[model samples]
Target: MKPLKIAMMSMTHGHTRKYYQTLKDNPKLDWVAVSTANDEVKEIFLNSVDGIPCYNSELEMLDAHPEIEAVVLASENSEHLRQMKLCAERGIHILSMKIPTFDMDEYEEMIDIVDKNDLVCQVELEMHYNPVIVRMKELLANNEIGKIKSFNATNITLSPVWAFPWQGVPEKSYGKRVHVKEGDPRFRGGALCDHPHIFDMIRHMTGSDFDCIYAEVAPNIRPDIIEEDMLSVIGRMKDGTIFSLDPSWSKMEERLKVPGPGWEVFPKRMEVNITLNGEKGTVMADCFGPNVYHNGCPNDRYTVQYTYFDEWIGLIDEFVDNIRNKKQPLINLKWHKRTIEAMNAVYESIATGKVVKL
Candidate 1:
């Protein structure tokens, strides 16, 4: 298959740094250009960047690299729509960050634009590609554990505000400034917006749709932001599988600009641990754990060093296959709508203090 001529937009996202190696090393992609949100981000992007041409404006980058076939929209939440429109207008395929947009109408517009352009639009929920998760899916499909009565998943991670400040802003991170309730100062976009993998995963695991969602917020670890740093949601899938999710920025951090070592005040920067209760048996898995440990460096504390990082390889490979072979990706826009809808239901549940129906 021919390699995809790819580009990345907005270097300010938390996942921007993670994609650098994947974009450059993947045999299926040719990372052609990058456009940052501002001069500060541009300087940060260029200072350590290797060969890719870093542009100050998307127009300039697109004009210079007209052959660029695909793009990874690594922008802030609010910038997704504008950047997506630009990519769609150019007929470029997209790999959007997890939360595309909170507004349903705007989200629908994005879908329409991409479909009209006949482009592949895949969302980034890297947990879908994790090997441990791949194993879990295989096990569940095989019914190694009988009917799942309840599932609990935790996607807790250190706050990215220090690294990606835009995430801490209500308007920038949540797509708008939304009051959760009459007296609640914290807006709708916060830790919940940052973590949607568990929500999305439940749908995949149970092969069901969202039924209703109930959410509650906790006291913020960092009180400076308008977004909540902690949240919990309990819901039932249409298939009758009950689930609970803890999508909080509960881990501690050292305020590093880039996501790297010594970046976490806690030993592990992130955790995606899950537990399931079933009729036949039960299982617990840590998708990103049981990893290599290290006690070296700036902090001599023992750390679970990550060894597996091929999610982008699988994701990009799928995109390439979709383009080259004319097959739809597993996480395409159409397939991901339910996940987005489920996420929205959580917010609605929070606002009304009642279970939101799908």
Candidate 2:
């Protein structure tokens, strides 16, 4: 297949930096121009990348590079719908960040817009493409652990709010500024908004939708930010599999303006580990692990230097195939709606202080 001409918009997402290498290295994609949220972000992007045109606005970038066929919407959660609408209007294929929108009606509008444009809008759920996750799925399919009785997973990471300020804003991260619950000072957006992979992963593992979810919010680790940084969720799946998930920003950081070597105060920084309790046996897997360790350079603290895998390569490959072959992606807007719904239910459960039935 011919390389798809692709550009990235709003270089503000935490995952935006992760895509730089993939966009440049992937033979299936022609890395084109980029549009940043502002001059500051543009400078940040330009400092690292070379020989690529950077613009202040999407329209300016699009006008200059009309040949651009697809875009990676690496913006805040609130910016997704507007950006999606703009892309849809131009009939451009989209690779949206994980949380498209928190509002269900807006999400439905996104689905309609994409459908109407006959465009491939693939959500970036990179965990689906992780090698460890692929192998885990294979084990589950082969019944290596027999029938799953309980699914427990942790998607914990250091907060990116220091580097990406939008994540710390309630309206920007959660698509609204509503309080998390009655009398709670913190708002709806935080770690839960950042981590949706475990919620989506359980569905693929168990072939079940969320039955009910109970969630509780802990005091903010970064009390300066109005968004909740720590939370826990326990839920059940439609297939009778119970689950406990921790998608918290429990790991501490150095409050760096730009993410780099010394960003982590915690050694591992990020972890997505899964444990399955089955009738026959139990299985434990670490999604991003088996790494090299070092306590040198910027910080003398011991840190897990990750031997990063190219999950984005597989993800972009599927996006390209979906566009070229006119086929739907595995993690398309329609297929991912339930996952989004489940995430919203987590917020509802937190607000009501009761189990939310799905």
What TM-score, over all chains together, does every model reach?
0.96, 0.99
Give the best candidate by lDDT.
2
The lDDT values for all models are 0.86, 0.93
Model 2 residue runs over 4 Å out of place are none
Tens digit per residue, CA lDDT, model 2, 97-131: 99999899999999999999999999999998899
| Candidate 1 pairs with clashing backbones | none
lDDT of 1 by residue, 1-358 (tens): 6788999998878888778888888888889999988987888778767899999889999999999998999999899999999998899888899888888898899889988889888888888778899999888988999888888999999999887889988888887888877698888888888998998888788888888889988888888877888888998888888998999999988888766787766788889998988888998998887778888886887776877777776777777788778677787777788888888888888888999988
- Per-residue lDDT, model 1, residue 185, is 89
- How high a TM-score does candidate 2 get? 0.99
The number of the candidate with the highest TM-score is: 2
Off by over 4 Å in 1: none
